[model samples]
Target chain A: MASEAQSSAPDNLPLVLIHRIPPFELSFKSWLPTRFRLLDPLDPSFSSPQTQSLVSSVRLLLCLGPSPLTSDTLDRFPSVQCVVGSSAGLDHVDLATCCRRGITVTNAGDAFSADAADFAVALLIDVLRRVSAGDRFIRAGSWPAKGQYPLGSKLLFSLVNITDNQTWWLFQLGGKRVGIIGLGSIGSMIAKRLEPFGCIIAYNSRRKKPNVSFPHYENVMDLATNSDALILCCALTNETHHMINKDVMTALGKEGVIINVGRGALIDEKELVRFLVKGDIGGAGLDVYEEEPEVPRELFELDNVVLSPHRAVATPEAFVALQEVVIANIEAFFANKPLPSQIELE
Target chain B: MASEAQSSAPDNLPLVLIHRIPPFELSFKSWLPTRFRLLDPLDPSFSSPQTQSLVSSVRLLLCLGPSPLTSDTLDRFPSVQCVVGSSAGLDHVDLATCCRRGITVTNAGDAFSADAADFAVALLIDVLRRVSAGDRFIRAGSWPAKGQYPLGSKLLFSLVNITDNQTWWLFQLGGKRVGIIGLGSIGSMIAKRLEPFGCIIAYNSRRKKPNVSFPHYENVMDLATNSDALILCCALTNETHHMINKDVMTALGKEGVIINVGRGALIDEKELVRFLVKGDIGGAGLDVYEEEPEVPRELFELDNVVLSPHRAVATPEAFVALQEVVIANIEAFFANKPLPSQIELE
Candidate 1:
């Protein structure tokens, strides 16, 4: 390492560090305030001794995307006072290490809630109504070849008249029993958005929230038992990992659908695939997978499973909102003001 | 024609006429009340000389699907008093003849409304969010090949920061202005469903609905001029036929989306194809075509448009509801009770 004297004099502007891996750099550099000098490790001078000295003095770090911010990485920037996360889920960040180090953490809170909730509803409708499957059918030049696509399940009321050759039915959305997992900001928004569609809402969370009228279940299994659809909106943690196993899925039964807008590891992907393959579960609308960008090949041919490229929070509107929150957190940190959306650390 | 003397004696049950072309017979025959004797034209007895005399005394006709109910056909059943239409749209029936003959018409009333509204919303979301396109991307194994799918339009706010190397964006649904054509039951329900999504709702109809608060326009052009999306929910009548022609589509502009859940002729299919092909309008989610089962083949390759096989009302639940309404109408007609879903002949 070069001597301290080799480093250039610090500018008057406050210094901020940007932690991101290659090909995933921050795209909102111009949107950030000019009052801070952003130190990017990917820069050409990053390996230089003088630049390393500057890196050690980075008091504020902006963690963009899934860039790992492990304890060892944090050790290089010993002066990091606050870590402002630009993504909704901070799984990449070692939150426990940050908490132990007494470093404040902020995330993009409520900024992506609306878009995520909208996507969850979209996925549910897509799976239930077979929107994507119908699109595929039409795209394959199969409409003329195939007289009509198969019908989806009826919404709630059952009028099953089984004749030898004919059956009369209706698939509605007016009264579906929807069980929401993790009734947080995103979950509550999902519930509110689905209310007008006349869906019956229930939830399974860490604890029953006060002033909420929706029925709450202590366990995910019980929630699945009563719901026609289960929307996963909870954060992934040690407790929630593999929470949706075979038993829980079995309880949801053959007519129950699953919509996941949360993290992939929150569910047992292998079990989900098995259940889906066996036709034990009604359908699934997945935006995330256990090993993303590597979805099960078995799901490729299934009509009931709708696969998305983890794009629930990929809306342009959500990004603008996220940018606002990220900027606010940065400004608040520099101005000695409270952060706009700090994550509560346990 | 057979003489009255050659006609067989009337059965104890009331006689009901079923005017359906071959291969399109109603599947709810067993569900029909045993009190009425259904007279199917395809019945082998109908070719018999005495069957013609029996047909003349039929007072109730059940028109199933799109079977033509022309005046010439009605003339064969001169004693027909009530026409119970099992389908929602009455375009196939000669309403003029029905009115002239003072024949009351009952249709599948609110039976199919919920499913239609649900489908309308589903189509709208699919078009706006590009759910079908994204699904296609994942299904074709393009996610790993192509890192990110193209971003859709921003929901409401504008943040155009186009750098030479990088750009930040999001496509949102929360703040879209949705214009509903035809403020009837389906239109109103579509508005109600989209309200929770933070969508701004407006409408165009023949007459302004009382007790309604949404901004209403008398002309569809004015409605399309200000809307990001136009949801066609009006009945296809002479006045409304091709109402969404070139002028209205042009006014909807480049970023506008069209969702048709109503009859196919409500829009000029030829004009729509040109607009969609030229990128004059952003996208479409069409369930009905001008000559359905024969959609414009051009739309098959387009990524923006979502083509559904006129399946908005093809759900089992809708069929069950339709069976209920049909049974109710038939029972009421025989009981001299008020028809459950009568259509007023204007």
Candidate 2:
């Protein structure tokens, strides 16, 4: 069911429009006035005329996804003040049209970074420890017959180093090089967490941000070559698709690990399989893949890969935070105050 | 192969007898005397007169296991000076026989307590969080699949009042009720480690020690009833066998977890399985079993159990420490010194 906040723009209605919301977005009343209409951008019933009718009543539009608004749709909303998106990427919104109409635009930027970082750490531990393999062994009835499975490799065991029956010395996370593919919101937060673990953070983004503390690499291969763990948190634009191909995988070395919490299309799936099979790279922790609903069955066969069901933001805390921020941004636009996170045309 | 230390004791040299061990015993050198003919009262091999080759050369008899010396074995080691046992349980050794023979008896009272405690805590987290389940999911290729498997529970899914992210807040061990079955060396160490986590530690043993900081319960059911997590770190003696039976399971409440890093016989497996199936108890983490190498397949099928192959002390560090301690205990007996731990005659 559509969230009630998305369905009705209440009486003191400052005239707001919203679209491209999931079924369970944030509760709007907690942070914003009820005078906001958060439209469903992907609503099957939406037509050209209906889009125009909805836009005509709003002073602002909270757009999500990559749906462009045509001139006719803009004509109905003469009082439109701004267009805000609940996503970081603004490719779908008609920035030129909004600028012509003097409508400002903003995007939800860097909000989901910590959630993604947490997921990266979880996946990394899952892969290294073979946590999943032990579970399968018990279910398969191979445990008691075989006694305990042979001790898992000490290389991947992330827990403490136990000794003398009482004192436990934990493994240190400090002093490892971490390669970030995209230096965006998620990528930066990942570096922040790793800092306490004593990691030397490095990044290979499309354009380097000067104000950052991590070393930047212009070449992804160089970053992969130097890093002990390579993280993929970049945007999936056409120019950066399948950036982690066979050549990049080869450069990662046999001891290096790869983590991807971003879009699956950003890595070369066949190349990853080949590298894993050949032991060219140590391990991989992936939350997303090239294809949804059907990942390569071979990925499951490898002991070094940690796979999750695209659930980095599946935590209840992140889910609620997502809704709260999206609704607040929408509300801010209608009231003619500064939007929570505004996007603009270059 | 048996550990090297087990095989190196000189058969023709002065004999050192270690008798009266606990139910769970490992052959480690925690006593003194670097070289001697070591006699184990609990060894099935000790029954035959053919094993009495050290009758003439024996100088010291070290009591380690709880098994008392039978007249046949004592007659064979006439030159023995000391009978030292490195266990709290003196059930296997005859203290009167040693006293009559004018042999000093020693015990290794609490060397393994802290390690056992650490093991209990690890098992609890492993079972409840489904660290094993997550491992199995990846191995089965059911990850990220729709209608696949019961996903592992997040860390803080049951906290009563917490606004912060449960995942982050509950990941660390703090503010949890941890119940100890026996307030022995291991149980006390568990309480110490859990104390830093803000855990309220409680114990149910023969009688609570006056020096311990943790609270005491009169019965096993009371301990289970009050604990958020009940840890079985007690020895498998007559009074404690099957202590956590159906009634204790019922008292533990549906949210309480049980961890048995001690002897598995302390918990009733049949009742545990029934409780797990009916959702009558929260969960359990087991290392040892009532019957070794004969675990039921049904236990693996349950989501509430985490099984370790009785290898909690199998860490390389622990192995090294065991070798050192067991060797020293044996050597001290040969040197005519006071044993590290002495067992009092009942």
Best by TM-score: 1
lDDT of 1 by residue, B1-346 (tens): 4675335344656788888755454556453535567788888997777767788788999887667799999888889999999777888899999999999998789888877888899898878767787788788898777553233222212245432211222247788999999888788888888998899999998889999999999888899999999999887778889999999999999889999998899999999999999989988999988885678989987778988877777666677788789888988999999999999787
- Which portions of model 1 show Cα errors greater than 4 Å? A1-10, A29-33, A148-170, B1-10, B29-33, B148-170
Candidate 1 lDDT tens digits, A1-346: 3665335345646788888766455556464545567788888877888767788778899887667799999988889999999777888799889999999999888888987898899899888878888778777877777453333222111235432212112235768999999999899999998888889999999999999999999999999999999999888877899999999999999878999999899889999999999889988999888886778889888888889877787666677788789888999998899999998887
| The TM-score obtained by chain A of candidate 1 when compared with the true chain A | 0.90
Per-candidate Cα lDDT values, in order, are: 0.81, 0.61
Q: Which ten residues in a row have the lowest lDDT in candidate 1 chain B?
A: B149-158
Question: Candidate 2: where is the Cα deviation over 4 Å?
Answer: A1-35, A42-45, A48-51, A56-129, A147-272, A279-285, A303-305, A317-346, B1-51, B55-240, B255-259, B313-318, B324-346
lDDT, model 2: 0.61
Top of the candidates by lDDT? 1
Please tell me the interface RMSD, in Å, for model 1.
5.3
Give the per-residue lDDT digits (tens) of candidate 2, residues B1-346: 5687566645545655554434324334333334554566567876668666554556666543224466667666777666655444443465567778786665545544444555565565455444444445545666545332121123111122334322122122234688888777767766755564346888888876987767888988777878888988776756778888999988888767888877778888888888877768777777777765567677766656777655444334333444445556666665656666655543
- TM-scores of the candidates in the order shown: 0.92, 0.60
For each candidate, how many residue pairs have backbone atoms clashing (under 3 Å)?
A: 13, 64
